[model samples]
Target chain A: MEAEAARPDRRAERAAARRRRDRRGFAIAAASTVLVIGGLTALILTSSGWPAVRETFFNATVFKESFPDVAKAFWLDIRVFLIVEVAVLALGLLVALIRTSRAAAMFPLRLLAILYADIFRGIPTILLVYLIGFGIPALANSDAEGSSTLSWLPTEPVVLGAIALTLSYGAYVSEVYRAGLRSVHPGQRDAALAIGLTERQAMRHVVIPQAVRNVGPPLLNDFISLQKDVALIAIIGVTGEAFQVAQIMASTDFNYTPLLCAAVLYMAVTIPLARMLDRWDRGRVR
Target chain B: MSGTPVIAIEGVTKAFGDRGVLRGIDLEIAEHEAVAVIGASGSGKSTLLRCVDLLIEIDDGDILLDGEVITDPAADPVAVRRRLGFVFQAYNLFPHLNVIDNVTLGITRAHGLGREDAREAARATLARFGLEGREEESPSNLSGGQQQRVAIARAFATRPRAMLLDEVTSALDPELVGEVLRAVRDLKQEGVTMLIATHEMGFAREVADKVGFLHEGRLVEVGPPEQVLEDPRDPETQRFLRRLLEAGRA
Candidate 1:
């Protein structure tokens, strides 16, 4: 009698399990269908018989002819990368210190840092670079004949690109630092206060070191993003670097191969750093 | 409450929003005296200890330390906090700092001690706490008991006149609690006045020179261990004591 009673219940349980499995299968099928459709759409759009794309992207002539100029462009990109990286780190740290300070005197400075970050981050980087490169010079040298602050700035495209990248990237980097500061345990600050360390002393000795360690992975990811964003400077007619070399080749040969090459170069720089960040994040979890 | 009370609380009340957490507490601890505050959760014992350390600002009244009004409206809170050390329940040692650096940080940074002198002081404190060979190890690498001891050492390294211990041993496991309590007991013997908010009835009964029972933000009873723990005068005190004993059994 007990076995007979349990049989229907077992049948119901089996039915529920079967239904769940069916639903899951349906969901997987729908997702795969969407993915396949999207992939096909992308392939069709990018591989449409555009002569520029076929000749410049696939043919070897454009690459060979532009190799030297592209090499110079890549070197310029490196210079921009180094300069922006260093500037962002230094300025970000400074902004973090200001934001964390308790002194009433620093309140205005903190407000200014916030304003700088918000304004720059909200606006397009190209606009800021254009303003700095073109607008600032125009404003500064309106009185002088063929002389401006742009003259004082390095004439080389590499130097111009570095300055533009630093100005835009530094603002964004400050927010990363602020997030790091917020991640530090409040108890750490209390511990420092309990020990009689002044606010500044505690921040320097206790808080910032731990915050930096905690935010390491995100900061590295940001660096990778910054690497890709460096290409934006090429829009300002700064050529002979990675992105610019591609642009020069694309314009001359009317093909997309150099652009593809630039994409590959970007992936090369970012992919390893991305993997390292993933490993770091996994280690933190463990 | 003789020999110039090291700490004097006169109608000290603390509140958050509309709720009164510490309702007009008046207490005193004589120099070198160990006072253990026993209470259930939300009794404001921790708040009172923080008030003494000036870690939490009081809403009303005064906290006098060394016979001076440390919590006076005009007094420098940072300066007052300098003379009072605090050990937290969670052992809030700087994770980035090694044992020695953790102990010597305040001495070197706040007290302006020479690095060598600060290190020597740190070494001596670590040795006192039986952490002689573990100076270079990060606090995270140490056991809970060792980390608490290091925290105690760091607190005592500055030679504060009084230390606020907020449920210091409450977070440790049963096996680990004794080691941390032992460190506190050692500090007591060495004349470090402490205001400890604790849940360990046995330790409170044994080591505390005076014990105060706090129930619902009020000090229901205050007396020596025997009077407060064994022979309570108040009904609330008896009930609290009973609950603690029953909980311990369970």
Candidate 2:
């Protein structure tokens, strides 16, 4: 309160105290991490099945051997992931736009978008994979009179799996997009419209950019989920993605080491994405 | 007030659900005239301005821009809005855009000017408003008064035929209100056709050629500022002014 207390050196003294407090906080965090890791290692080593468990799941030799095969198979998952993720983003945005359309002419499309989200979101992803993967092929082959109408559909298990994932995730991501769209203050769009931009032009330049920026974290979360769900294609029983290869190796060698490798691969991809999204969210807040 | 009417509102009615905000309002603004509508909060002054801009569609009657029925269902609201400028009470500058970009958006996107040319024009407009080196700064970073000035700059940059300012200074701090009112005063001096809604009685009296008093969604009285402010005939208008005087807001 006094002018004497507001001296320039007092500011530096307070800043130094703040730095010391931060250093203490960092020390506590490091100590806790070390303690937790130490406790986990001690528990794992002292377990009765430690040697056999290590051999079956954490075997260095088996890990090395399975790494190449699992890594190679993961590329297929990555391909499906990349393709489906892009398709999902586009489909989600389209569906979200349709659902939010205020025009009477778009009623049917809006209803269809609503229906797609409801049905696809309700159906389990694995079941969708089975139905599309096996059902479409069966339908195409069925010599029943008018069933050949489905012949143009891709019967390949991987492609069907991708389509199924696209539909399922598209439903989910559309909601994310919708929430983002709605999260933007109506005033922003009003300002754009007041300046004479058409609804679509305003949405494209102003609303969508802000909405997408707002939903960046959730979109990244969905992408990470999508990356992991690429393994779900293995449920179709044919495509040799990382999970399927891991399953095959586990069955053949009676060891789960290959599964561990696949798990590690997934974490490698997802953890970085999660971290990047967190950074982006924090940067925006800052 | 002289020349032909630039904006003509005829029996324009607007309602939100069952609550009518504007009750068959009729008003007209001549070219190069400055008309200020003053009233208590929720007196439909804002609704009137928004209706003219087509931001809020009127439920009944017609609005004309330069003698053409802009409220006719066939007219393109975007095209009509392109020819008119508006400043909101909240100074709704795009938070994602810097000051210059916010000012230039209308020219580049709506008026079909090239982006580079719009930017050049926006910079000059910002400079005219004493924001020369602040073009690249986001509006959120500016003070409330500066932000409102930028909003005014954005409205001015389009070279619109007429301008609508809806309670532009009502959201500002007491100290900041002067700068915004000064900008509006500057616009008035340039002979811009303006229909302004304000709670600032002194500014309205100084800047307005004509003043209208709105009460319960109806224009109770309208005339020259001297007549409306000094010699209001309606009891509601008298009571409104008396309340303002008691609050020391008049």
Each model's DockQ score: 0.74, 0.79
Worst ten in a row by lDDT for model 2 chain B: B1-10
| Residue B235, model 1, lDDT | 96
Q: On a 0 to 100 scale, what is the lDDT of residue B3 in model 2?
A: 59
Candidate number of the best DockQ: 2
Tens digit of per-residue lDDT, candidate 2, span B1-250: 4555999989989999999999988889998899999998999999899999999888999999988999988788999999999999999899889999999989999999998999999999888788999999988889999999999999889889998999999899999999888888888888999999999999999999899999888999989999899889989889999999999988
- lDDT for residue B127 in candidate 2, whole number 0-100: 85
User: In candidate 2, residue A149 scores what lDDT?
Assistant: 70
- The CA lDDT of each predicted structure is 0.84, 0.92
List per-model TM-scores for chain B: 0.97, 0.98
Give one clash count per candidate, in the order shown.
6, 0
* TM-scores (chain A) of the candidates: 0.76, 0.89
Model 2 chain A scores worst on lDDT over the 10 consecutive residues at A141-150
